[model samples]
Target: MEIFRNKKTFTDYIERQKEMGKRIGFAPTMGALHQGHLSLYEAAQKENDLVISSIFVNPTQFNNPDDLEKYPHDTNRDLKLLENTGIVNAVYLPEVADLYPAGLKSKAYNFDGLENEMEGKSRPGHFDGVGTVVEELLRQVKPDNAYFGEKDFQQLAIIEKLVQQLKLPVKIHGVEIYREDNGLAMSSRNERLNAVQRDAGKVIHETLVKVNDWFRIITIAEINKRVKDIFDDQRGMTLEYFEIADEQTLKQTDFFYKDKNYRAFIVVNVGEVRLIDNMHLD
Candidate 1:
């Protein structure tokens, strides 16, 4: 895989590819590469002539300093993983200066109230950071297609809104969430969880599955209470927020509407590591 640590060279390469009539696909990540990330690459490769990616753990997205400090980082392993796929033609490994040349700040965006949803409500200024780095990367790459994992369903919605507000000519694709054999959503943060905590994390997916089964059969209120009770019983897991919301707008709904599709979003604090997962409440 071609590696780029500089902006101008990266853009020049992308321009050359575009001039050759290549359709580019892009996926921006925070570097601790996993199968979930590669899955996006595979999806991109199927439709685009070339696929590119960026790996920069953006600092502005983190509300907790410790979370930032504790984020998983493994450059060698990440690079190796990307290389193994042979689908990624280039990967941008930018320093803070390379991405944020203007002294590190997120551009102000009102993702049309998408900025105030679940993850947004839980962590302040999170989407601003997400929007900033994403906008920066998308501008530089200018790909025809972009891919994101559905594991962060809310963030995916926010990014779709960001792309719209910016009026960028790119299609955003949300690939299905990748999971461990036990159904826990795959994440870099999973690296921090001990074996015990990892096993405990299974409860998250289990609960999501139960909610899926209970979705329209029971009242929303009872389902909410049942979800809470399940997590409340787990020893090391803390239920952060669980919402069954409109599938498209991401607006949390108290009751399932007859005309709208719904999805269940949940965040669980497993010990110190925060885990997020969502299931379509079909």
Candidate 2:
């Protein structure tokens, strides 16, 4: 796949594609590619004539500077993997300046109620940074469709809402979360976990699995307690939040949800790496 690091070159390439009447599909990612990310690439290839993926580790999204500094990067390996995928047409490896030029004021994008809980509440301004960078990338690519993983379920919901609210010409599609054989959800952060931490991390997924019950309706606090109990059983792991909420609205539920659609999610710290996982409450 062709690689363009500068904005002008990437835009020109897109211009040529537009002239050829090719439908564009884009996947935005911070480097450290994995099977979960490649799955999005596969979905994009299936539905669009041209597929573009961006590999920039966005700085503004991190509330913790240390987390930003420690985030994984290996562009050479990532490029090789993308090339092998046979699905990515071009990879946009833009510098931070290319996306955010000097003296360009920061733009604010928030989902009101949805932005204040779970990951957002824990890491303030996290989604604003996510929205800012995603808006910039979506505007730059101007794709007919964009693919995101359900692993970042809340972020996917937020992006969908942004596209609808702004009338962007892109359709957002979500790929299901890819998991390891032992059930730990695949994530770039998984690379940072030590052996014990990685083993303990499975508890996050298992807690959700054990707690999910009664598709019709069940008390949210009861489910929340069930998840917290599982986390409590695992030492050295701190529970950040356990929630069951409307998938689209993301508002936490206390009473039983009569509506059949929602999600069970958790964010817990296994050592310094914060892992988030969710299972659809069917």
Candidate 3:
């Protein structure tokens, strides 16, 4: 597969592809790829003639500098995996300056009500950064469809909203969240955890499931409190937020077990790693 590290080269490559009249499928990621990320490529490959994958660790989307610094990176390993896929047509490995140049302007797109809850509440200005970068990528790549992992359910929601609100000519499709055998959601940050912390990481999703199960009869407030209690009971886990909300609108609800179409989400800190996960009731 062709690798483009600069705009001129990447844009030229895309122009050539356009001349061939091939449909493009794009997947944007911040490196340290796992099975979850590969699943996105598989979806793209099945539906499009060409697959474009980007690996840039976005600095703007990161709320904590330390967290951003600690986020995993292994271009060599990632390339090996993508090469095995045999479906990736090109890989865009843009530099930080290329994505957001020195003294460059940054733009933010408001995701209406979806940008200020759960992960947004915990990481202020996070979605704005996400919107800025994603908008730029979509405009540049102009793919027929883009694949996003449902592990970041809220981020996917915001991107879908951005496309609709701005009328960007691209479809945003979400792949189901992938997890390890122990049930911890797969993430690049998982590499940061030591063996014991890795085991403790499972508690985050398990707690999400436990809290979601509680929604069957308890009030949202009670369920939220109970979710927090699990983290309180567990040592070294910091609860950021545990929320139950309407899946599409992301507005917090009193309770949702009866509706059977709501979503349960949680964001918490395990040592230095910040993790988030969500489950659909239906």
How many clashes does each candidate structure show, in the order listed?
Answer: 0, 0, 0
For residues 1-282, write the lDDT of model 2, one tens digit per residue.
899998999999999999999999999999899999999988998999999999999888887889888998899999999999888999998887887876434567757667776788778788888888898899999999999999899999989988887899999999999997668999999998888888777777776777665434556666666667777887888988778788877887776546547787888888878888998986
Candidate 2 global lDDT: 0.85
Model 3, range 53-73, lDDT digits (tens) per residue? Answer: 999877778778887777877
- Residue lDDT tens for model 1, 1-282: 799998889989988998999999999999999999999999999999999989999999999999898888889899999999989999998889877899788778898888888888878899999998998899999999999999988889899988887799999999999999899999999998999999878889998999989988999899999999998888988888888999788898888778999999998999888889999877
Two-way lDDT contest, 1 vs 2, winner: 1
Using Cα atoms with residue i matched to residue i, what is each candidate's TM-score against the true structure? Answer: 0.98, 0.95, 0.92
Q: Which candidate leads the pack in TM-score?
A: 1
In model 3, the clashing pairs are none
List the RMSD of every prediction in angstroms: 1.0, 1.6, 2.0
Candidate structures ordered by TM-score, highest first: 1, 2, 3
Ranking by lDDT: 1, 2, 3
lDDT: which candidate is best? 1
lDDT of 2 at 268: 86
